[model samples]
Target chain A: MIEIVSAERCVACDKCVLACPTNVFDRGPGGVPVVARQEDCQTCYMCEAYCPVDALFVAPHTHPLPAGSPLREEPEVAGAGLLGSYRERIGWGRGRVPGARLAVGPDLDRAGPAPAAGRAPAGPARGARD
Target chain B: MRLDADVLVLGGGPAGAWAALGAAEAGASVVLADKGYLGTSGAAAGGGNNLWYLPPDPGLRAAAIAGRQRLGGLLTDVDWMARVQEETFRQVNRLASWGYPFPRDASGQERRSSLQGPEYMRRMRRRVHRGGVRILDHHPALELLADEAGVVTGAAGLRRQEGFARWEVRAGAVVLATGGCAFLSRAFGLNVDTGDGHLMAAELGAELSGMEFSAVYGASPEFGNHTKGLMMQYATYYDERGRPLGTAGPAGRDLLARRLAAGERVFARLDRAPAALREAMRRSQPNYFLPMEKAGIDVFTQPYPLRLVLEGTVRGTGGLRLSGEDCATTVPGLYAAGDVATRELVTGAASGGGSLNGAWAISSGTWAGAGAARFAGTRGPLPPPGALRPAGRAGMRPGGPGVGRAEVDAFVAAVQERVLPLRHNYFRTAEGLTESLRLLDPLWEQARDRLGAAPGDGRTALRAREAAALAAHARWMYRSALARAESRGVHRREDRPAAGPGLAHRLLVSGLDRVAVRRDPVAPRLLTGAGVP
Candidate 1:
């Protein structure tokens, strides 16, 4: 579930509101989007990924975190660079290499000569960059 | 609000986007109504997808088709496979021409066979807009409208962003690219994929094919919601005693499922994966590793508990049956595409997994869109509102007064119990299936007769419809499973341990209150040139 939307870092761009598939966020005072329907968050991280200023923090838990947990304010959490990490990983914003450049196609030879009933070849090998 | 269009495409995933583009290019006025934001909605928007992008090399294409023929239970159509390959090849290159930023190989040649989900959908949404298609984000179509002759003419839905205001679109034709049902299993980005299209189309007398194969499952962390199973190919499984489970390769899914069914805690480590590829995996699928990284677990080395998340018809090969190569359904002016249409034409009884489905979405979406455009062109003009009748039954036009919130919640929970468990869905038996039906049948009755929402409460109405759709979907799946008494592809019936020669036909399922199933034989020509007996 989403944990926080930092007011200081937020640009009030409304990108997260438009990008969220479930409409979990509602634009609030001062143009900032509040997590109005936190329960509807599917934890897909689209809000975090689309945030331009890295203002959002989405915990990986499928359910809501405990109230007033210190983990929300821990420097280690931010120090570990978990905030807006999905955007960085996908090479989305500034100074990032596009992740689309890393994708590889399937090797046709792996289909093999003989038919393997009930066992189709696995999809393209993930992370096979080399 | 009332709108008119030459074509009204429902659900704004890859299929719906492509459909809108195809219709616009054909000079049809198009309107795309999505249940959520276009670029980020549906299953394809949340993960990387591989396309079946075989070049026009006859030998390679022939080899690709033959390899998966037997695996698909010999129900695949060779011509359809070739057509999809050809169409996918054309479309991806077109995307590249439109500046899709495809990755280059070591030799600097562009690789057009794979796609990053976020980038792909973002580009598709932009292209659809540029093509003059009107997009209505956060608009969920609740029902289809048919004319006096029973021809589907338009649809009615609620604008969820506008205080549940009613919106209706009268179109010359309609295309349903609404994806498939995951039974609310929380598979990544599939929460909105509740078989809405299937239920709406079925209400208008459309049949579903290969629903028996709806038991597909993907491995995920027990505490997380990501269902990307590609990384698990290299992982090794262990039992609660820290002993190796000895399950190897994709064929070992049955063994792993059996152990899981026996009440054993299953754990896995990606120790077998090449260390060099870890960074690339993170780059390729960033969301897949987020849960583990946040929980401070090294998935590459440390053991983590795992469970199978049911993907239902989303990954499984079953949905609205197509009656033509143009992707039209049995109902006039109604067409199906993407996961909403059965993949038996290309994938047969097996799941498309990613590649085949990705390609099918592009190919079928284009075909269905153009087909719908051509269909609308033949009709002179949109029918008058008086001539059209709303076809939605269970939720839209309930037989009795609306049920309460508690009843709707109970219906969803009851459905999850019968459908989500691996023991019930994966390791199937006649007794287990019959027992599931006994419980699910009455729920269908309640959904059809009493399950409804009070006026102006769109959220509750959507939930009610979703509950009805899930129940309707489960009944179709179990009834089809019972009819196909064989262990073929993903429809594994433990009691019938072997595939029956006579059961080689695709099972067609239809009906509302009382579900029914029948065998539709594959044409003899479709079975040839694929090494089938």
Candidate 2:
């Protein structure tokens, strides 16, 4: 299951909504994003990882397996290099694979809008933390 | 500052959503305001409490009715209760039919049950939206407005992330669906709950029905304040020999079922156990507690675990007073539901998903809201200039996020010095709670004062959220602990050890005009009825 987004905690900043690989959230008229399609959750913790406020929780899925930093797998975009090929092989939209585990991440941008300003470097920052 | 909606639901959990949807479907222009985001209210959060009393067979229907009848005053109208039950089933069924995966039971029946905690939250949130409940997140209701005759007019609150963004929403009917005061005692340090809905309703002079029956729940043992792991991990309390303690029965399901049927409230106490069972518990790996890495390995292995726990965490059962069907207090137009309302037949074992019970709240909230709206219509909407400041608005001094090195250092020292290792569990005494209050209050205040500017732009807002929750928590604990001369259910009193007579069914009400406590007058054994004592 996709983690819970403390929507109350959400600043309506649209960071995760824009960063999503799928257009899962539809920004409502009131400026908050609506869970446009919750069923599409691939159980990826990307949204949680990227949530600066730590307002999300992905369930039943284990936390990133304990490992030494840097080498530790980033939850959603685990294998970016692999994901790129997977998306291309399936001929899915930008960064999306036809059926290969459609969780909340993938460096592949997919069908969503451009990533937010501070979000583009998520991979490197994640790597740096590792 | 002025806003318009056909129906304004004060809370955004299961009850609020159902009420909003029903109102909207009934052709009301609906606006739902939640202090938290969608799916995070009393219903969604805290392991949703949607429970149905199903019989092992059709023959047990009579048994169920008999059980209800035996309880008498303890039992809500079975027909009305059944109506709430049917509506809940319909809503859950509607959610499942929409493709949300609600796990089925052994009989392949839609479990139609809320295991409780965050898992239930996720499911209910998904289900509410899938069911088309529109929500306005982060809008916490601050005040319930009333006119000259004490009729409730409307409500107002602030936008958390947005500084000073105030909203005054006018509704045809206003439903107070805000969840109860658990976050109050745990966080705020107040003895009595922060009294959000109660305070607002009191401002309108609404007569709260049951102010004494406090909704009590055990704090998460080991993991201070987390309620999830207890629900999902099904952490069974066992002796050193691995024999289940308390209402011991094999398996979590069997034990819980037996306890509830017998009207026995469940509580978890820490104690030492044999190495074998300790190892088994260790292997089971409860999630809510601090990881062994943090609290220490023996944390789980030890007996009489000295930790704040989460068990029978009542969100105020005998807390507020209210009449039947009408979630109304003594004051007209002011209504309560979820945790803030009355804890009657709907409380304890009769509930399921927190939000799933939105139907219950909706029935009451709708009546209250419509009544309030009708009242408002007579007085006319409070003019834009007349928008009232939210009642109970504590103007907290702003500060930065992340405790400072000095504060952290002080906290560690204080914990080492004053934090007793004794079972500082819920069985509170006047001196103990007072001692805790004296020790913890200064630290909390000092931290709030000394902390530099809130770190992030929204840090001030976040701190306010934390402070409000903390204040409410402190108020609830101190007041409830002080009020209850005896211990019962979740509220264990160290001063008065055993359950006293004549106070069991008698409800407790805080001066705030909400039902604060409800006790069975006499133990069940003493009663002619069939309820468990």
Candidate 3:
């Protein structure tokens, strides 16, 4: 769920509008942002992360229930932009790019922060690029 | 407001971009309009895909070209597919020159991956931005404007900037590239694919064909599009008892169905791929591994749960029927390419994603763009605005009162509930289609009466139109399914399990009030190879 905690703090940079892939936000009459497509939010935090004033709070769905679980129980898929294909479509653990699956214990929560994404993470084949 | 152009392109995806570029470069004043910003919108913005490239080896290129010719028993336009096949070599080269930075081997050869996505689009958008074509962002054409003589003059679209207002474009020719129908389907960037081009063209009395093949269903555990083994012969499947079901292919579908019959949950797991394959996945999809990381389940190590659902018609077939030598539709002054036109190139049971579609977007867009410009030169100036007519007096908030959010949501939900369920999906039967049509009719009725939006709020208006288009799209797919009494390719029928012995006929549908349906054989089969006449 995404919440603009303090709308007053918003400078109306409209960064969220540009950052959004699904276009969940619409500019209202006074340039106030409205969650016109709230149901479509994939919770990628692009909006929150891009918000300079820290006015937005985004709590992404946890990994307690696996994806592809029945609908209405929870969102079966994520929004289809930026991180959506990774978190929703390309099911990988530990890293965004392909590699030997990261070692995780039986308990799901202990799975640490994702291996650094975007810049091909250091796979077992180290120093292969430079 | 009035905008004049020699050619007007009504979408801004790869196809639309190339179309605009083609027309503008050919000295036609072209204006490309997109509902969102150009270059960064449509399926392309989803990111990291091939705009059609091949491995450096001559043998691999020949094999890929030979293999694609074999879809749906030579369903694609051979000339068109072959043309795109050769054109992509240059298209990839052009994308690379624009700083796409495609991953290469140690020998500096561009490594090729079968999976396609938005990376190519990202670079293509830069190229489009550099192309200097006239572009209008946040402007979606609401209706195709036609002259009294029935030739399309231009289009009327809505722009949602400060508030909602109408934008009109006067053009000698228009290219419709609004993509295909993927009603509520998640894969293949179906969210924005509301079949706008189909509805607008159909409103202008254009015909749609091969809609029965619109329901192509496949299984992908995490992400569907570009997932190598999801539908292809690559992934390993696990049944409810955790028994490995072997590699996925046409036979894997049988395994999937059998597991479903046994009430076994199914999953697709990727084997630990080597660095080359891993680099290939990253270069093509880039984000394919994120979902697994989020869930703490490694795809290479752990099994990912997959579901079988109908692919959006963007990957199947159904759109404005292309005719004659050019990519022009039956409606004159109108042309279509990419996902919005008849997919004669993606025939048979092959999945229509990645390089095939990427190539089509670039090549067909160029084809339609050049064709439209040539036609524009052949014709006189666009007719006066007063002489042009709206697609209809009713569909556009044309009624007594427009609908609100509630009615529009209800209409969308109605289709989601009625037509999109698996029961009414891939395995279409006479009874199931009849029921689907029955449920879809009331929603159509509701669309006629209540589908409306506030003027300034273009989002709601877009949703309302999509709701109507989704209904029409579903109706066409189901009606076509009912008309085709045999099973073939993606149009699976429980009662009729095999491709019936007859000429492969494309189902053509026209009109909105009383839809006209007909079957026309695919003349000039492209490949003319094994198992087909």
Candidate 4:
């Protein structure tokens, strides 16, 4: 579930609100979005990925973390640059190289010759990695 | 608000976007309504997918189809398999031409087979918007509208972002690309995929095929929701005592499920994966690793508890039955695409997983769109509002008094209890299936006569309908499963352990309160072509 939205780093663009599939966030005072319906968060990390300024911190728990949890502290989260880490990891934002180049799977084009009728292919299954 | 379009597409995943694009390209005005943000909704938006992108080599194509045919229990049509391959090839290249930024190989050859979900959906949304398709995000279709002659004409839904206001669209044809049901198993971005399309189409007398195959599951960390199977492909299983469980690969899931069902804890470590491939896996599916990283567990080195999350019809190969190559349902003016339509034509009794399903979404969406456009072109003008009747019955216009929150919650919980458990759904027996039906059949009646939300309570209303759909879906699945009487593909019947001869036919299910299942004989050759059976 989502833990925090950093006020200092936030640009108040409301992208998280628009990007959230489950409507977990609502527009807050000063244009920033608040985690209004935290229970509805599916922990899919779209809000964290869509945040442009690295303002959102979504804990990876499917259920909500306790309020007293240390991850809720802004300094603990922001100081470690944990906010919007998903975006960075996915190489989605500015100046990051596309991560698709690193993808590995069966080479369909060069999987040797086709197998005999009713027989399994000779090479590794093409879509096994998917 | 009221809108008019030549074609109205529901659900804004890969299928719906492609449908809208196909319709627009066919010179038809299109409107797409998504329950969530277009680029952030449905299972396809949440993870990576591999396409069944075979080149036009007959040898390679035949080999591919034959391989899957064996895996899919000999029910796949060779003609459909070849057609999907051709369409996926063309569409992937088209995406490249539109600057989709496909990854290049070591020799600088673009790899058009796989897609990174986030980037893929973002580009698809932009492409569809540029194609002159009106997009209404956060609009969930409540029901289909039918003319006096029982032909589908339009649909009504709620605009969740606009103060829960009601919205309707009159269209010459309606395409349901609403994906499939995950039953709110928290499987990544499938929260919006509540089997609404299945319920809506079924209400309109549309039949469902392969629903008994809706028992698909994926391994995930107990605390995380990502159910992509790629990483789990390398993991080794263990019991709570840290002893090796001796289970590996796809077949190992049955053992893991049995142990878990027996009240034993399960754990896994990705030690079996090649060290060189770890980085590539992380980079390819970054989200899959995020939860483990945050929990301070190095999935590569540390053993963590895992659970098999039910993906239901989302990854499963059952849904609204198709009647033609154009992806139209039995109901005229009502078409199904993506996971919403049964993938049995290409995948047969097996789950399409990522590759075949991704390809099916592209091919079916395109064909359904063009077909709907042609359908609309011949229908003259949109029917008047008075001539159209709302076909939603169970949840929207209940016969009894309105149901409360508790009832809706109970219905959903009851459904999950029957469908989510491994013992109940995975290792099925005749006794267990009959018991499940004994419970679910009554819930169907309650859904029809007793479930309703108060006026303007959009959230509760949506929940009521989802509960109805889940209940209805559960019945269709169990009914078909009981009728099969033999283990084939994902529908494992413990009593009847072997695939019975003369049982290779597909099961077609229809009806609402009294769900019915019948065997539909598979034609020797669905379409004339090379490699006909």
Give a tens-digit lDDT track for model 2, residues B205-233: 44433332332333233323333322222
Please identify model 2 stretches exceeding 4 Å from their true place: A1-130, B40-50, B53-83, B93-100, B104-109, B114-134, B184-195, B202-307, B310-319, B348-393, B396-425, B430-473, B476-481, B512-533
Query: What TM-score does each of the candidates earn?
Result: 0.95, 0.58, 0.80, 0.95
Candidate 4's residue-wise lDDT over A1-130, tens digit each? 8898888888889988888988888888998888888877887888877888888888877888777886788888766767778888867888998665554444422332333234333211113324
Residue A113 shift from truth in candidate 4, angstroms: 21
- Model-by-model DockQ, in order: 0.37, 0.03, 0.06, 0.37
* lDDT accuracy of residue B372 in candidate 1: 94
Give RMSD to native, each candidate.
3.0, 13.7, 8.5, 3.2
lDDT for each residue of candidate 3 in B1-533, tens digit (9 for 90 to 100): 78888899988777888888778777788888887656445654543343345545656654555566444544556666666766666666665566554444456655433212333444455666666667787787788888888888788877665356888998889999887877755543346677888888887788887787776554544333322222132357886666887655555665675565355778876663443454344333333444344445566667777766445576675667888556899998899988888765544334455446667777778878888989899987667888888774224553656867777787788887755555567557888888888888776766766677766557778778878888888877778788878886667788877667774656788766566678765553455444433
Off by over 4 Å in 4: A105-129, B522-533
Residue-level lDDT tens digits of model 1 in A1-130: 7888888888899999888888889889998999998877887888887899898887777778786764466465688888878888777898888777765434222222222345445421111111
What's the true lDDT of residue B176 in model 3?
Answer: 92
For candidate 4, give the DockQ: 0.37
| Candidate 3 ranges beyond 4 A from true positions | A1-16, A19-21, A26-36, A42-130, B50-66, B112-118, B218-234, B257-264, B272-284, B346-349, B392-398, B454-457, B521-524, B528-533
TM-score, predicted candidate 3 vs. hidden true structure:
0.80
Native-to-model Cα distance after best TM-score fit, residue B444 in candidate 3, in Å: 2.5
TM-scores of chain A, one for each prediction: 0.76, 0.41, 0.45, 0.77
Q: How many clashes in each candidate? A: 0, 120, 22, 0
Greater lDDT among 2 and 3 belongs to 3
Better candidate by DockQ, 1 or 3: 1
Candidate order by DockQ, highest to lowest? 4, 1, 3, 2
